[model samples]
Target chain A: MRISMDLELQDRPGQLKHVLTPISDLGGNIASIVHHHDKKTFRNTVPVSVIFDIEEQTLEELQEGLEKNGVAIVRIGKMRLRARTHILLIGHIIHTNLRETIDEIDGTGFAEVQDLSLSMPAIDGPSSAVITIMATGDEELKKSIGILRQIAERKDLLFIEPLDERGSPGGVSNEE
Target chain B: MRNSQSTLTLSIIGFGAVGQGVATIVQNVPHIKVVAIADSKGVARMPDLNDVLARKRGGQPIANSNLTALDVIRTIDHDVVVEVTPTNIQGGEPGLTHVREALKNKRNVVTSNKGPLVAAFDELTQLAYTNGVALRYEATVGGAMPIVNLIRDTLAGARVLDIRGVLNGTCNYILTRMAEEALDYDQVLSEAQDMGIAEADPTYDVAGIDTACKVIILANAFFGRHATFADVDVTGIDRITQDALQLARQRGFAVKLVGDVQELTVSPKLIPIAHPLNVSGTLNAASILTDTAGEITVAGKGAGSIETASAILSDVLSLMRDRT
Candidate 1:
């Protein structure tokens, strides 16, 4: 599988090679290594993104191997997932913690709130927000919607979900 | 008869409980053939598997050859090698060497042994990848409970946040009995040993080493995190007092030996009775906290000769599917 990992490394003579060796040892073929040594911090740590393809189980060993060797992994894999779906949430979007709402979706590990746009005319008036979600696939997207629906109900807000192309009347007309 | 499916030859190393169990199940399968069998006593070419099993059941050696398990793996002409040897944590031993030989020979491997995987997970898995062979060990973690396959096959793209499992059937049985009867750890352990649920030594199971191995395997399989027995913060149920169980019971909780991969903890923890991890008896369960599926829990018989053999069969069938 192809995976991209963001790592912070010390700007030493062989710091980059030290991080790259584990990936190679664990049967991962390094695709690219982007080192930002020019933007090294005062502590001499540079942010690097390494892309590699590895066997399924090797990925875990590589991760542990890296951690054991003191390599700081910021994130692994693609930040944006496949299959994007847009949904709208209405009513007191900000009053109910918007960060929590986003986190609830992001925490699922299968889906994330990729982008959001919110509008509130008055402080007391009901607000609306449009959220674009990146999910693993259809089934995961459905689960994400299910969680959002429950949150919306408990928060007493209106949630307009994404229209399913296969089940929607507008989609049928467009197909015809 | 002309057919599209290919017949796969299999070599079995370590003719113990798990090895015999696989042979028993494969008796009904026509596509897979057992060509070679190796045990501590000797190694033999078993073209007629029924006769070999009959000899083994009758307390006679299958054959007398000077071949080591590694030697059979190297010289044998088989599509796959099923390694069912005992686990040796110190250095992953004969099983590790056997696995390496099998992968080097371009043969797939399905094993119930935890030693090699725990000792050299990265190197062995890397070897398999380099040699274009698959190494599957579903029976290593939860026996027939399907913990490894559930996370690896079903939850493919789902990112796992944390994994908590009742991985050891022996520990689970002891703790369950201790709580249910309000008995001491020693009493419950003796009962488990009498019932064949635990080994005579019982240190491996009761001391949390077995559970630690399972959690380590899960950590690597899901989170790509490698951990060893030392990494797990282990606290066994031997010190759990009856009063603690009773107090937890009053508070609507049950004491369970929970193994968490993310935290690398294997200890007796208080879980609500209604929780999915709160399973009883020899049943093993795993709760996988994934980003998309939320928390998915699976529970079943964790260890048994036939049950584990069923997992081995599943891995064998998986290999067949990939080859076809």
Candidate 2:
């Protein structure tokens, strides 16, 4: 997966290395990088976009990782920026402990539930919402979704269609 | 204290996937430290894991901290260097710079990057010889498989007649997927890229430059001939269609991006036949034909963090066995 990191840090010596340390330090394989060196006259922060490729599973925790080092990762899309996927599960996720379910989804390293939104109804009513999972590419997403659907079916939960988010079934960027 | 287990120093100029893998591997290997790790941009050194932490997760980067490649070179008084970068087309980067720097610093080198190896093999080999050091590269030809070592050691006594096989996993993967799934060229290639089997800018693999690089490594070792990437014929999998892949499979064969180097001619073959490589997924296989050994076929995981690391580890072990 190729992640885009936007950093707001002082333009100081060894700062780029500081921002990059966590990425390299965490064993992420850098792909192509787009570094906008043009100084931002507005703030002392250097706005840079560091793009790199990493395993799908490692990325979910990557943003949280960058912010810890003070890189200021403004955004990390759950759709999986480069070569991963996003899935949504709607049901009584909180009752199931969504975090644990996500952990189970991601434990395979092939897929992970990136984010979730749950809507709980009155005390005896059914609960429902959504879970956005970022899995490894399409085939992996299928495999992961297959597992999730199985889990959902067993638990009487719901898995929605991934039509709108991802494009033509011929596959993403088929022509490079 | 000329040498300390904690201060092992090694410098890596090409800080790409393979380079990162090298650094990660060296970090896990105790008694070594990465003092300097350089890429095309610049360099940095993390003496220990604590020196750098992850920001995204607000925890720690899951990387090895004991030794950055540079620390191994500068501090631990590294006995060897490992270079892993891309192969240069007209010219390469940290691949060449790293190889030269390590050799000039009197350090043995083990690189998987064929760019520097093919472009400046003679110079780097001579530099190592002049310095009385061993510049070994076991990961050059086949990413995870030990084709280099197989040639340099296993078949050392065999009269190698020719070397050929699907050396490029990306092309092989594209072709294989096209055949099985009946996918178009573009579709399969995209999937391969997303799967991390194909390069982002897949010019090298699709253009047969990757096969050419492997052929150079094989030719130099087997034929004792100076070979260049340009010397080989280039036919990328890009031009290959599902029709081609289908024709291959229908004929009871799997189409492979074969790098054939025998008697000095490097050619690429899209063979559709029932080969061992008919085995599914991103595995790499190589066949070395020798007079004494007839033919040997080996296949295994060709890429990834730990797999590439295993190749460098073998080279390090080789160096360890011969201290003098």
- Best candidate (score: lDDT): 1
**lDDT score, candidate 2:** 0.63
State the DockQ of every prediction.
0.01, 0.01
Candidate 2 C-alpha lDDT tens digits along B1-324? 134444444555455667666766766676656655555444455434334222212543334444544444544456667777666756556568667767777787887777788887778788889978788887876767888888888778998877776777777777668877888778888888898888788887888787787787788766877777667765555545454344334333445566677633323332324445444566778777788877788887777756776787788767756552
For every model shown, what is its TM-score relative to the native structure? 0.64, 0.57
* Tens digit per residue, CA lDDT, model 1, B247-313: 4565455667778888887876656666777899999998888888788889999999889999999
What is the DockQ of the complex in model 1?
0.01
Q: What TM-score did chain B of candidate 2 earn?
A: 0.85
Q: Single out the weakest 10-residue window by summed lDDT for candidate 1 chain B.
A: B239-248
* TM-score values for chain B across all models: 0.95, 0.85
